[model samples]
Target: MNEWLIGLPEDQAVFVARVAIAFVVCLGAVIGSFLNVCIYRIPIGQSIGKPRSHCPSCGRMIPWYLNVPVLSWLILRGRCANCKAPISVRYPIIETLTAMLFLMVFQMWGNPAIFGLVRLQEPLLIPVYWAFAATIVVNSAIDIDHGILLDRFSLGAMPIALALSGFFPGMHGESVWTQGLIDSAVGLVGGFAGLWIIGLIGSLVFRKEAMGFGDVKWMGLFGALFGWQACVFILICASLLGAVAGLVLLLSRKAALCSAIPFGPYLGASALIWLFWGPRLLDWYVSLIVPAAL
Candidate 1:
């Protein structure tokens, strides 16, 4: 990378890099704008594109100027221009969150080169993971709002992940693309089977539905994106998170003992964690469990 910039002045290189980062942030915000549509439309089977953005209370079409992600919300004071009705803060929040998350991923994974041999092919993974993160966020929002995960988003991403696996260089001391695909397959099957089995057992013991099937699908999808090894850590992390949060809700009377909580958000959050920390977390676990193996 330095060699590519060898002739360029240091200031120019820095300027170019900053511009590239800013572009990513802007793009992320736009994607978040689309996500707001998805969050509102997907649950109702509405076409995300046909109607364009409009105010629900006044039924007035939202102008392009008023629809510019987070900035628009701040400019309008979080109210509809036509109706003056308060818009949910979720709109700007999602936009800002998506932008921040994109920046975070770039900071963590962005380097001069990604793949050892295919330098150009490596940076493509950034957007790949970005879409995955977006899908997870959208799915989590839906699950939180509607208590369901769309199969179209969760299960639909599997084939894309599987295809991407062919190009994904395997990590964890493996570099073979075929090995990467195999890891994804293992993760998918293992996650689905593990969740299904646990849910089944829980239901049998309690004589009620202990878990939603949507969560199983979402987990399976996550496993496909990462791998079977990651599924273990992700499930462990999500379960603990869900348990702690559930207990808090119960204790605070926010929810009843039998109330169902959306589990997708926990899973999504865990996957994001694994996305950045999977390798380090696995290394730490292995070191603790098998000190002599290394």
Candidate 2:
């Protein structure tokens, strides 16, 4: 732990931690508010930047104070102040989840050098990651609801991912801009082609669509940001998680074995895990398997 994180006495440490937690919570809430826009607009073919948020039921533009993330929902009793129409709990939940992810990313990389070098210092990165996560969340949710991943959300994320990976030193192994470009290109090719091949083979054998194009593009985005190896790890982890989830759903009679399950959420979840814990998990897996092989 950093001295600043641990230098305090036990009582003081608790206070410090609480303050940090509160800051993270506030950040998450704000990001969550924006993510709501992305979620609603991306699917409906609306411009996220052009339209100001309004009550879906009444079309009343939300006032600043009334749009204060989770607090607004609570204060309004989960109803729109303008029309008294019940608000979806999804807003608060998304906001809170966004905040938690932000805090987790902060805690994972505490150094200013890493943050600064990786473009983490920018306010935009916070929302960027939130949007990235939101893309996965929205896609997964919609897929679960309707058995499809919307192209607009998944495809829209590619350029943003490319731009971030291109400039961020931590995302690319080398600090040089050129190397970052190369890494990103390699990542994109590796990610897309790898999954596309798998999808093709699976479809040929099963005589149906085994994987969607949205998933291919999603993996490519992950690769462009995280690199080819992390993309592979993400794919493996997602496959494992999806398989287990699918089995559970089937055995419980919640879904038929043939039912199409959205693999995007698992990919997103695995990508996040890889982002934070990739090295540690890799080492642990190597340790386990190497010893067995030896």
Candidate 1's C-alpha runs over 4 A off are: 1-8, 113-121, 171-173, 247-253, 256-260, 291-294
lDDT tens digits, residue span 1-294, model 1 = 535644567687677668868988998899999999999998998999889898999999998987898999999999998879999999999998888788767656564422123222355678887888898879989988899999998788888877778677553234788887888788789888988998999999999987899999888888888877778888899889988888898888887642555778988999999887777788788889897765
Local lDDT at 52 for model 1: 86
Cα-lDDT of candidate 2:
0.76
lDDT of each: 0.81, 0.76
Q: For every model in order, what is the number of clashing pairs? A: 1, 1
Best by lDDT: 1
lDDT of 2 at 149: 70
Q: Give the range of the ten consecutive residues with the poorest summed lDDT in model 1.
A: 112-121
Q: How well does candidate 2 match the true structure in TM-score terms?
A: 0.77
lDDT of 2 at 206: 100
Query: Could you tell me the lDDT of residue 97 within candidate 1?
Result: 84
